[model samples]
Target chain A: MSYPRLLRRTLLYIGATAFALWVLIPIFLIAISSFTPPNEIYAWPKPIIPSRFSLDTMRFFLNSYGVLNSLRNSILVALLTLAFTLAVGAPAGYAVARFSFRGREAFRLGILITRMFPTALLAVPLAVTFIKWGLYDTLIGVALIHTAMALPFAVIITTGIFMGVPKDLEEAAMTLGCSRFGAFVRVALPLALPGLAAAAMFTFVISWNEVFAATILTVNNRTLPAHILTTIQASPLYFRFAGGFFMTIPALFFMFFIRRYLFHMWGGATAER
Target chain B: MAAEIRLEKVRKTFGKVVAVKDMDLLVEPGEFLVLLGPSGCGKTTTLRCIAGLERVDHGRVYIGGRDVTELPPSKRGIAMVFQSYAVFPHMTVAQNIGFGLRMRRAPKNEIKKAVQEVARLLQIDELLDRYPSQLSGGQRQRVAVARALVMRPEVLLMDEPLSNLDALLRLQMRAELKKLHREVGTTTVYVTHDQIEALSLGDRIAVMREGEIMQLDAPNEVYDMPANVFVGGFIGTPPMNFLRAEVRKEDGGVYLAVGDFSVEVHKEWQEKLEGMVGKKVVLGIRAENIEVRPTPEGGALPARVVVSEPLGAQQLLTVQVGKDVLKVATSTELSATPGQTIGLVLTKAKIRLFDEESGEALKFD
Candidate 1:
């Protein structure tokens, strides 16, 4: 094309490549180091590319004490968090999207305001309350905290999802022999499925990766991240890399499976037709 | 099964803005009643109220003699065609049309038969397997109509259903809707701001203004005998011209005195004008009712043509009479050009007088 257009295109490519490398390079290093043998992991001026690869580090990390139990706990907690967030947040989102009520704006702001408090600030008080309620050191206790952490995002995402579904479709269903609740269940829910999937993925990933609340909430029923955090500093270099790489796997697979839905959500519900 | 709908003392408001003020209306069974008004005049709100979509603040809604004010829309035995033609984008045409039947838990074979029958009626049978996104605007509209019609509801509510279509398609669909109504004979309440649609489709038109029905009558009567200034002005294209005049008893005859000229009141209206003497009134006349001639004829008021537009079959002439500009629809054969002095005669029986202050029509036997 013209000179300025060619210069602009080259600059855009450079910026995009730089951003991609910024995110991918760290993940790449951890992944390669996790596969590297323990002897080569901490070589002087560490190798940019691993010359030898083995599964010994991964095997050792997987077989370590409490690693398998903590993996199970992590999956259970993430699933529970997904269920709790969707159950609570979807309806709240639908309400915020559909209804015009007193203090609606304030209510929405209040939901977001919960996120402003750092986990560090809430952990000690939450631990005391959990002990009184008999939820201390339990997987349910950790999952509940994760739900609290992820719920704000869930509500905000689902509000946009439900808003994207036209109010007329629900009204049409109501007039077509469906009650208001029935209309919501049959029409609005189905139309909002893809976006809801995207929201669920976010909840799953957030619970999967969260460490701070998991560490504070439970001891014996430690999730993957909490287990990794406690052992990684004392563990060998290869074990630390393996632990980091293992924690990233479930979240990566979750993103991969629902990548299409994420695109659908970002493209928006109105883009359907 | 056709059903009657009645609203009594219905009043609805949003926050502080009143959408439908205190109102009462009755629709005879199987009749097409059109609620015609400008936007925000509450025509759509009234339709929603009848459909149980909006609960009335202070009224009872009766559908087929059952007080359905507290009922949800599903229990109201009504179907509504939204202006957006809200056929579910995710569902194929068959599924969309069968949705209501499925909701009612109808038998599968029965739902299929009903859907196919309605699809054939709407002539969208071939597109039944296709999704809404695959259909044209007109086709999607037909699918929406079929979906509503297949429900066989007691009352069908349509809210500006044809407003989204192009002009030519709107006219075509308008005719189809009329034919469909004839065949179905469902009691229909349609809302639209298009005066032509109301005139052509409604069995009786309710002309509304400021959340109140100004007139409710047969289309011809609404056009011919508007109840007030708003109805008169709102109902017609090149709307009714209004002139300020005074009721004067001169030369033993009752005359409506214009700025410098006067038209004699008919003998039948003389008694009515006698009491209205010395009172100011507004005279309403349609554009087609006035006759224009090149020469000053007997009993013809003097006028000058300011602008003449040749509209193929007829010429629309903007003529000046005193301080007022009048739009006249006359024969294209008349070669009346701009700045030409012309004589105008207002048909005696066609003249309508309204109270200046209240804008209410002055009726006479």
Candidate 2:
């Protein structure tokens, strides 16, 4: 290669390596510290590699008061958020992408504008309503708020997903003895599956990571992130590292399982052959 | 079985823009009717209304003697092939062709047999296991056709089906489609903007313009006796040449007085010309109907050639007659250079006259 082209490629590699290290090093440090014995975790200078591995810190973090309950609450709330968001947002997205009616653009803008309001401002009123409805301090109340928070992103992403599927295929199905709904289910749905999976992943991640809404809505049923934020400062350094490491694993596993579908969100799936 | 389709005073509009005006049409059973027009001329809209894809604001549509105006596309007993050849990209060729049967809950064996038969007919049998993305454009188009034909629909609707193909493949597929229609004998309504395809593939051509049908006739009748000036101009390659003329009476004989010269009107049209004396009319003549002669003859109009284009089989000469330019197609043997003076002989029997104001053909009986 010519000198300039070689120099440009080398610079690109350097930038990519720096970015990779920047994201991976903190996770690496927490993982190592999480497994290190309690005494070594408090060493004068932190070791790059642990002297020995032990599950004692992880065991203690798991056995702590409210930790296991909060872990279960987080999974339930994230699942509930995903189910509610898709059930409501998918049809709304389909309508937004496929139909042209008065106020269509306004409806989309209105959904997006819901996110512009500060969450803190709505907390007192939402908590008051939840208490009246007997939903405060319940997992369901926290999940409801997370669903509301993730809905705009779900609708927007699924709209783009549905738009990538050609209207012609659906119309063709309708002519071939399928009703309008049937056409959507058989033809448009299959074509949009990958992108929808990507949307579901985003919804899950958003709900899992959201702390403010979860913390404000639930007192006894705090999700993992809300529970961690409330208790991490009081804990020892080893417990803090173990809690961080535990929280990051589920999200990492979720992403790894669905990594192939993530590219579909970036226009890898199109109608053309 | 083939079934007739009838539209009664159908009209459709989209937000104050009329896509199809009040139109009436009848397609005989087993007849292949082509709706031919320019873009935005409502031909496709008319076809969609018949297919039950678009609802007419006023009027009724009947298919096989039943009122189907309120029915959805599936319940109307019609199958359509879209311009994009919308084969299901996620399905294999066999699955695509068998989708209708599957939707109707056909038995697995029956569905497989029907798909196989249609695939063999379309000559895509070997490719039935392949996905749409693995096939060529032409093959995917065949898969689409097979899917529609497998339904044995009462009426088949096609919206510019072959327009996406290359020119050579389009010609090939056009012939294949005609043959398939003949074999199946299904009533079909096809829409296209190409005059050649309309003339070749249609049993009857409905020429449309500006949301209305200008003429509906056999291909030969449409080409030979166009009902209006628009049909005449829109149907041919080097569209018909028109010149402004006025009817004049001299020596007890009627004549058409073009810019600086006059031609005697045919005897059968003399009386009609008498009533139109001093009235402006349009004189339309096809390029192939005008003959170029080397020397001036008794009834030939003298003209000067402006440009000559050799199209292999024949030569097209642009000749100036008085102040108007006319296209004349002649045998390739006749070589005429630019600025060369030539005599033009218009075939009197084939000449057409139109009202200058309305652009409607003036008939002489």
Candidate 3:
């Protein structure tokens, strides 16, 4: 209605729009640059566009230094981590939510405490232990460590999901025909499937994206994140940008797969606790 | 329309707190047995014990003459409709009702037929394709009943199943539950804290208090001749009014001394209460049985109506008598405003007396 109000409103809109662009621009540039010809990629302040697009840099990242093997290792490691976390975490979540066993409250507190310890603190000791166990470069070793890393989060997410399911329904199942375990499998678990799916996806992504632990834990058998670190940096800024793009694709794809349950299980919960 | 069920000294304890304490009950074949009590008073625990959902700490359970305390619910041949319906959200109504049938590995054709028949019986045939979330509260309630009945188990246990429904729906469902039980002929154990439900639906009601059954009999008998103060007070609408009183023998005549007045014990009651003479007791009378009229020839306690709750057919009158407030329900269609002086009479036949210390009925031994 007034000029100052109009100007203020216009300034606010521009500020908000600029903020959004600032966040998304680097991601967009990495995607475009990852496909650019390496000869022109490092030119000047930066090429506004890749006049000729090629997959050479992406192809190079895939083959050289066994980056493709790293990708496979990361997927395999993440999958194993997801499976183990869900297997161990789901039951733990159910027990913490539904039962009143001794030290149950302490068990929940213990899960939280495990997450509080810095990953760096465990890296050296874990590496030393892995070597002794003949698992230093093995995917299973990486997966087990990743499970411990992802377990607290998996347990917390699924605990919330199990709590949301009314206890009356499970008890009702018990009365009808189900044993206590049967009720969980036939009733509670199925209802919590979406939340469990999201938890598994998240644990996978966390395992996939982890580099410090991966670097410390392995030498030749490395994950994508650990392998990328050796070649992603170049004398040129463009290679760094290209590597960023390569690391982000799997995460973006995985995020999309569980995007529905992200807002559902994680967004509301993970932010607070 | 119900199966026979028996509990022999069933006792359940949760840590230090006893939930159902050494309860023994019997339900006749084709009869509806309702366990009624306040929250935490063990009605639900009793029902769950019968369903084998909860294990008894020290007793045996029997359904249709076979010992079932050691058997699981399915093996005991019982089905339960939960307060929350317990219908699987992922399945259609048909699948939910047919689940037990499938568990029995019934022939596919028979399972389909049973589900269809129960669906039609409960008028949920059209809802068979829909999920539980798609149905209304009342529709889901019917679906739960259909689910339990389709199994045709020997017994059916329901725990406060109608409590989640709206008032109008509750009344409608109560009537429908009676009709359904009549048709299905499964022995049913229904539990509720609502006195009205206990009265209306239970063929025989067991009034429980503090983990023990106070009284168990035909619903009308439990209502009319309650065993003790708690049963008398707990099994009626607005609850029966209880006041401290003393029974005394005066001038070769037996009398009960109540608040602000004394009434001559009717000859029949005089003999039954002879032992309570000169003893302090609780005077119990239902709200409706406490008549407020113009001093009826006998000396009646004069009181002022403190508040009047007027329903169209009947009204509840809260009156002050000797520093104690009493609720009196009237069917005379009389209107009395607050502070209006009224004569209240406690008719002898309708009066109940209990020992003050033990709270046990003081009747002829």
Candidate 4:
């Protein structure tokens, strides 16, 4: 290879690495500060690397009023939201992908338009309806609202996923003695699994990190993100940083669980066995 | 024993576009019927209707002795191999072949045995454990065929299954498919736009055009005696030459006049053209049947050679005959050059006549 081309490629890699660090530095700072001892968090000329590591902030956050309850509530709400979003959105995606119906495009556009509406605009009306339905301050109510928030994107994402699955496989299944429903179960569903997993991961992260509707719809059953927002201003800097890290940890793990599927869904459609 | 398939007056329409119009076809038991046509000619639609993959707007589909028009694909007792090799990418080949058995909840041993037998028959036993992505195109297609064959369906349908293969592989698989059909003897319906594939694989060929069957007959009969100008032009390479001619009654005998070259109509067509004395008709003659000679002979039409294409065993010569260029297939060694005048003799009995208005074949008595 020519020295100029090799030198140019090296410069390109250096530029990309610099940009990556620029984006990731704040997240890394937050991570390190979450593990730093409370006394060392705000030390003068703050240490680029803390001399000591401790879990005192995490322990304090976990022991705070309703913190553990909210943590449990957040996990429950995210799971329920994932289930509800998939239940309401996956079949809609399948229908939009596979069939030509009157108003199919209109239906898709209508669903996507819901995402343009401010969540805060719907929060008050949804809160009022939940109160009237005797679902106020319940995890189910909060999960339902999160499902409403995530469903539009979920439907759009899943539609693309199902569209990636070829119709030929389903027809092949049917001709091989499977009923229409059987074909879906045996062929299309399995091929669409990676996309479905990615969509589920997206819903779980959205519900886990959501705050406005969670705070509006629930008071006693506030999710972890809602609880942190209500109390973070009053907490110490170290405690606040620990709370942020705690809420982010689950999302990180969620991404980790579906990282392979995300790669498979987007690239390497068929890897050598 | 194999079952017969019958489609009675099937009509299918997609919105305002008619895909199949009042199509009727019958496939006898154990016979290979090929639906041959160009793309969008409704041949695949008819096959899909038989498989219950499509619903006919008005018609009945029967397999064996049972009406299967209202049945789902699984209940229709038929299997289909798609043009794209549709073997499941997620499953191993053995699982793909055994999927039908598993769907029917057959015993595990039975499913394994059937899958093994089919894999062996297709010479893909070693590939049974490999996923579709790991196999080559031909292997994947064999796995698809095995998957359908293991079902032991009453009728088997294939939609241009060999079109995806390369030319040499297509020829090899064509012979293999013929051998497999002979061994299994399942009533088969195949669809292809390639006339060569149709002629070689089909027991009977149904030539379709614009959502209608133009002719349904034995392959040799369809090739030797095309039902219309379309079939004649579509079935052969370097297609048939169509010349417009006027039928005239001269000296109490009918003769076809072709720009200063008039030939008496054969005695076989004498009765058929009795009432059509002054009518314009299209004369259809295949390239292979047009005999070209270097020497100008009596009763021959003189023409100039435009170009010659050597095709190994034979040469296809384009000759100019009174401002119309016609393709003539001659022996490769028959030496001829461009701008050279040659005498062409179109055999009388081999000439076909078509109605200029309707493009329908005019019968000869």
- CAPRI-wise, candidate 3 is medium
Clashing pairs in 3: B2-B30, B2-B186, B2-B187, B3-B186, B3-B187
Cα error of candidate 2 at position B152, Å: 1.1
- How much is B342 displaced in model 1, in angstroms? 3.4
lDDT of 3 by residue, B1-365 (tens): 34588889999999999999998888988888888998999988888888877878999998888898988766778888888877788789998888877777889999999999889999999989999889999999998888888878788889889999999999999999999888777788898999899899988999988999899899888887888878888887788788788888878778888764786667887766676678888888888777788443457778778999887779888988777789998875676888888888887788777889988887654
RMSD of 1: 2.8
Candidate 3 lDDT score at position B121: 93
For chain B alone, what TM-score does every candidate structure achieve against the true structure?
0.98, 0.97, 0.94, 0.97
Clashes of 1: 0
Give candidate 2 regions above 4 Å deviation. Answer: A1-22, A52-55, A253-273, B295-299
Off by over 4 Å in 1: A1-16, A44-47, A253-273, B295-299, B304-306, B335-340
Candidate 4 residues B1-365, lDDT tens each? 68999989999999988889998888999999999999999999999999999988998999997999999998988989999988899999999999989988999999999999999999999988988899989999999899889989899999999999999999999999999999999999999999999999999999999899999999888987899989998998887898888898777788898878886678877767878988999888888888889966787878899999999989989988886789999999889999999988888888999999998888865
lDDT of each: 0.91, 0.90, 0.83, 0.88
| Regions more than 4 Å wrong, model 4 | A1-22, A253-273, B295-297
Error of 1 at B292 (Å): 2.3
**What value does the lDDT take at residue B80 in candidate 2?**
93
Compute the interface RMSD for each candidate structure. 0.6, 0.7, 1.8, 0.8
Please estimate how well model 4 matches the true structure, expressed as its whole-model Cα lDDT: 0.88
The whole-model C-alpha lDDT of candidate 1 against the native structure comes to 0.91
lDDT of 2 at A231: 92
